[model samples]
Target chain A: MSGVKKPVERRLRGEAVPALDVARIRADFPILDQQVYGKPLVYLDNAATTQKPRAVIDAVTRYYEHDNSNVHRGVHALSQRATEEYEGVREKVRAFLNARSVRELVFVRGATEAINLVAATFGRMRVREGGEILLTEMEHHSNIVPWQLLAEQTGAVLKVVPITDSGELVMEEFERLLGPRTRLVAVAHLSNALGTINPVRRIIGLAHAQGVPVLLDGAQAAPHIRVDVQDLDCDFYAFSGHKLYGPTGIGVLYGKEKWLEDMPPYQGGGEMIRQVSFKRSTYSDIPAKFEAGTPNIAGAIGLGAAIDYVQAIGLDAIAAHEHSVLEYALAAAEEVPGMRVVGCARAKASILSFVLERIHPHDIGTILDRQGLAVRVGHHCAMPVMEHYCLPATARASFAVYNTREEVDVLMAGIRKVREVFGQ
Target chain B: MNDLRDLYQEVIFDHNRNPRNCYCMKGANRTAEGFNPLCGDRLTLYLKVEDGKIAEASFQGSGCAISTASASLMTEALKGKSLEEAERLFQAFHGRITRDTGGAAPVDLGKLEVLSGVSEFPTRVKCATLAWHTLNAALEDKGEPVTSE
Candidate 1:
């Protein structure tokens, strides 16, 4: 469990990494195999961004080294190869999300851009004066702000579904919030600040029953669990590549074909144009219609490689191991006097958001980082959740496929040091 | 990790846990709110100025050890000093913590010199300066909330 010289490469197609072999899995992320402050690095910030596997880094390097060219417009060999690889990733993402067709998958910069795209187009199309857009208090700013912008423009009111003291959403309150004026409902599939896995499927069902479309922000969910957009029946889904062990500047926005067709193009540019004139410019069909620019070609290929890496490891194994680690982390952190775990949803992923008595989360983060344990602090870009608890901020430690119990112990020790510094 | 010791000295921890003047001053004439939104450190500094001198300085807020300690020490340093003298000490103290040593000292920071270690932790510079900026705001009668971005 201490040292793994190499990652396990040869395996049955769907064979999961054994729980005891997390060290071997950790070896694949080269960035994890390092020291900080002369101590072994303990990275617990997976929710913010997961470190890339060798496969993803190699894929990006391979793309740049061998086939570096722009896609969709080139007739040359390099251009054609680049286009194929870039487009190939679209199909891979389609399969990863289990979307109905490649036409449903639109590649954008990241979840932020994807949501903004939908808010600018689908939101503008549907939301109207005095109409409502429903959201939850657990939403990240990315999910909240874009809708706020659209509401400001269209005079649409933004209604928030409150969360319980335990950080879980109030189902009855959600039912109450769902009304005739609700034009759209956007919420997080998994809370990035809290580890609560929302009942998006049921939420989607409720919204669709009211003839209102739903968008699930899967930026935090895509990395942790298996998500099938078709099975969930969400009208739209958004997720980032960086959080899924892929490179930055690439993400996916999955919208139903009908909505994608009805909504105007988010941004007009060369690739998304059917025909271009000063008077009127018709748009391309489906996914291409939403994706306007040249796009993150290398980032798309790298994301494909990341998806392959996760599929090979098996998400079931990842989930089981992460759940155990989170349990251990929660218990260990709670043992410290005055320690309070912020999110206590019965159903949660692998995030431990907590605060020690009289210690600022940023100070805790700084001390933990000194011990080479990276944890996220502050509001986790979900200020509404913090406001709900009347807390200024929280310290968060999130686990991933490659994290081990040993790393969790290191984090616990670092937290103890924080307690000592505060003299608690 | 050894350098962290320099950043979180015993003096800082003691002051952080039991900050001096850690409340709103009664009959305070000048007051301003300071916020470091990135790290969620927020403080309100109150100054009682009499004859252009700070008769009292107090604060109320929540922040990291460095920030709480800095604000605590800043209140101690600012009390009984004239407005111009307080501003001069602010410059010297700011220079010491920020490692901008080129500025000549108008007044010795004394106990505030413990914060000299903060310069090494570039991210913490804002934490140490939040109080001073708020004091600056209070002195100028600027009611706008001071933000150390």
Candidate 2:
């Protein structure tokens, strides 16, 4: 554990007071101020789902407390208030991503559904038989399975861009794979398992040069780094709100306005129809046409509160504090005897995945759990990455804004104990 | 972490470190593969049964210590037992880990009793029984893969 702290201290350079007060930030997340397994909870499973801050929780509670009504169709005051707040989130997301317009942002269940919306609709509408859908091996199953389903339905081929042993994408290989048969290139902006931040801006530019569209699975990126969909100029981007410390059952799919207008609606229901007759029906508009049913009104409003909360703390400050934790945790984890860190990409983010010698990750996870260190120990919905590394699974520790350097020490101590019990 | 110590007993650790009957039996007539996709635990359970009686038992795979040790102990106890006896032993061993027999082994299970502490860890019950499940599949002569879903 001392080895872990030394590297972090070197990185910190004697600055005890970080730019963002993590202790003050920890207070906002009430769930953090509790105990698990008779020990103080050291939650490091942010990549799976983050704990909601008080503001996001209060926003949901306040909705049920006062503004409990449906949106977009009612004449009553409660309905109007609910409608305004719900739609207000769209504008907030629009600004958050620096998207061109609110018409481009559509809310869905999550990143999985958002990808499926594009697959089922845009994929079903435009993807030709024998066309190729190129993806990297590091993408989550949510990103991979949708395209595979699309391939099965359309007889289109699914091509993959291989990753280096260090978990970074091979740019030359990606460029070579993008040929005439390639219709779309879909890739993750940041790997959930490896923490490898792909050169998405460069990848998007390469795809655009070939007149191909691209979709960035921003599930792991949106929470940890700055995302400018406009600057990147991606045709489509998807992310979930629950991972961003908001509510579940809510996410955003930002598509270029032209693409959304050109593609057909995903689902058909009351809200999406402009008019309906026995003979024919006409769709309403881009976003409403996509979000057909009565949406999770409370979830969307709560997501709006989350965006406001993150903005107040600022993404830059949150990222800086998390980066410190990452560097410190890395130095500590490397000190574990025979410890093998899975992903060592040159540029990474708030995740650290590793395995101890002679110890299965499941045992390691169980031992860590007994010490109240919550980590995700599985394929992480990215099984190909595991297969690529010839591993069944790896233990992952992902940090967030509220995490402190001390928590990393606790994690290292717990890992050392794992070795002690195993006698390794 | 007393529970951790109890779960990873010295005998279990010894067996995991040097598993007994860890091989594919050459004259084995029955074989089955077991897989726990979630944990990436896969093993091939081989049995040599002649005239409805067990002749030999062995297994090969990779998994956590609890699972590896469980398979090691299971194969050792299963040798020289008749088919009916093997079935009865499986019931007793499984019941011990699952705590279905009022938290006590109904019969003397010998070395297999060390794994009784596994019942406390609900998530690891499948790991302890994965080899046994594969053994059941081999005895049935289904020759298909088994899953710990």
Candidate 3:
């Protein structure tokens, strides 16, 4: 691993902390070197999806070029090598999330699928017709829709905890809503649209007090925060690899050993069963029970490489660097007249969601695209949050480890150009 | 910035800032709502038809500059036109914006031709045509809201 202290050493010496060697970090991501619309590309859409480093790219390429075989059932040498690489990634993911065991982690398509798996299996088993599934207003659609489907199927009611105007969760309301009928409490660890870092540890504690299992949607958190599922004691945690600078089509769902054992298999397919017969079939244990058919072997290996890449730089360093950059951006935003930031939580991450006066987000997005600043402009799949704010959409600029203060300046300049275009 | 300028021309900015007849018309015989799910742009079209001709047209909604301008200009161009002419104009406007000129004789779109730049931005074509789609739905009396998916 890279020297973790070298990046933040100045802080220890009572001096101004030096920024991460972003030049070196930027060099590792080959996609960051490209140009768009005759200007150097400034990618601020990390919340939507992060760009992959060359290490991850090469790991996936090497897998497809050399070790190309199905996992587990292969008796050939190539198959054995592929299975070793594939299974090794499970251990890496376990360590990345600091989970109890690799068996507790199941590889799914993405965070969306991981939540669906929990909702389909655990939700189907635990929630009764009158049971309540509690959620927050800031949850992404992935976390909300699955439970809605479960509620629709079982006639269970979905109770929502509201957020404050500054995008912080109303903790008192959450405590009040954790009633006797509440079976599950699912919420986002970090708001994708608002950049609010939710107090998931407290949320888990309250839910555990009520004997309710809390499932955390870490799709936005895992990329920026240090996620220790054990420390938080969350019953379930989910995150996508793509947002963590890894490949798409692969993610991790970390459930407690007991929960994984109690929940039925999400899908029945080859390799998930121990023995098939004419009568009934028994399923394999935990991870294998959830992973059905041919998995994304290369994606898993690439995710392992991604974990290694981020670990070497250190999560603390990444978080500190992104936090400083976000702070800088927020301060710079004050210079732009008529600029209104949508979310102003006391604690936030690398995302900056804001709106310029009267100019629509789409127009801002198009103008920024011409200036080679890629920002996400929409409701960010959190329509309820938009409705709460009485806005159709807001332009979002999310930062990653590779983002620099200079790029944030360019973004601010792009907003000024948008104002010029709209005659604001 | 030429393309940006073309997409958000001064005229577009003007209409977006100060839309004409941008209100719910009273005593409207035909009304329909349009929704662009991609960007959450929505508008309601109000038309007053008399003796097979449109006597008044107006709309009220929130959308991007391109969409707002297209809607405002559409209300101006569509007034005092027969239903048949409106349909033909829809076809011509759609054809011009979508670049689907399959050897059909081109119809003069007049002021609406400024939106021809939308063809370059395939994504914004929906924004440009949302008002026209609502007009179509209003004329047909399709009570259901039209969606540009």
Q: What are the TM-scores, per candidate, against the unseen true structure?
A: 0.95, 0.95, 0.97
Q: What is residue A277's positional error in candidate 1, in angstroms?
A: 1.6
Candidate 1 lDDT tens digits, A1-424: 2111012222212355465477688889999989998888888999999999999999999999999998999899999999999999989998888988999999999999999999999888888999999999999999999999999999999999999999999999999999999999999999999999998889999999999999999999998889989899999999999999999999999999999989998988879999988898888998889888888999999999999998887776777678767776776776678789998997898899999888888789888888889999988999889889988899999999888878888888888888886667
lDDT by residue for model 3 (A1-424), tens? 1232343345434544345899999999999998898999999999999999999999999999999999999799999999999999999999989998999999999999999999999999999899999999999999899999999999999999999999999999999999999999999999999999999889899899889999999999998999999999999999999999999999999999999999999999997999999899999998899998999999999999999999888787788889778877887887799999888998899899999889899999999999999999989999999999988889999999999989999999999998987776
Poorest stretch of ten by lDDT in candidate 3 chain B: B5-14
Error of 2 at B83 (Å): 2.6
Tens-place lDDT per residue, model 2, B8-116, is: 8999989989999999789889899999888888899989888888888999999988899999999999888998898888888888878787656388788888898
Question: Residue B146's C-alpha lDDT in candidate 3?
Answer: 98
lDDT of each: 0.88, 0.90, 0.92
Alpha-carbon runs more than 4 Å astray in model 1: A1-20, B102-107
Which number leads on DockQ? 3
Docking class of 2: medium
Q: For residue A364, give model 2's deviation from the true position in Å.
A: 0.4
Lowest lDDT block of 10, candidate 3 chain A: A1-10
Which ten residues in a row are the worst by lDDT in model 1 chain A?
A2-11
Candidate 2, after superposition: displacement of residue A158 in Å? 0.9
Q: Which candidate would rank higher by lDDT, 1 or 2?
A: 2
iRMS per model, in Å, is: 1.3, 0.8, 0.9
List pairs with backbone clashes in candidate 2: A4-A332
Chain B TM-score (model 1 vs. true structure): 0.94
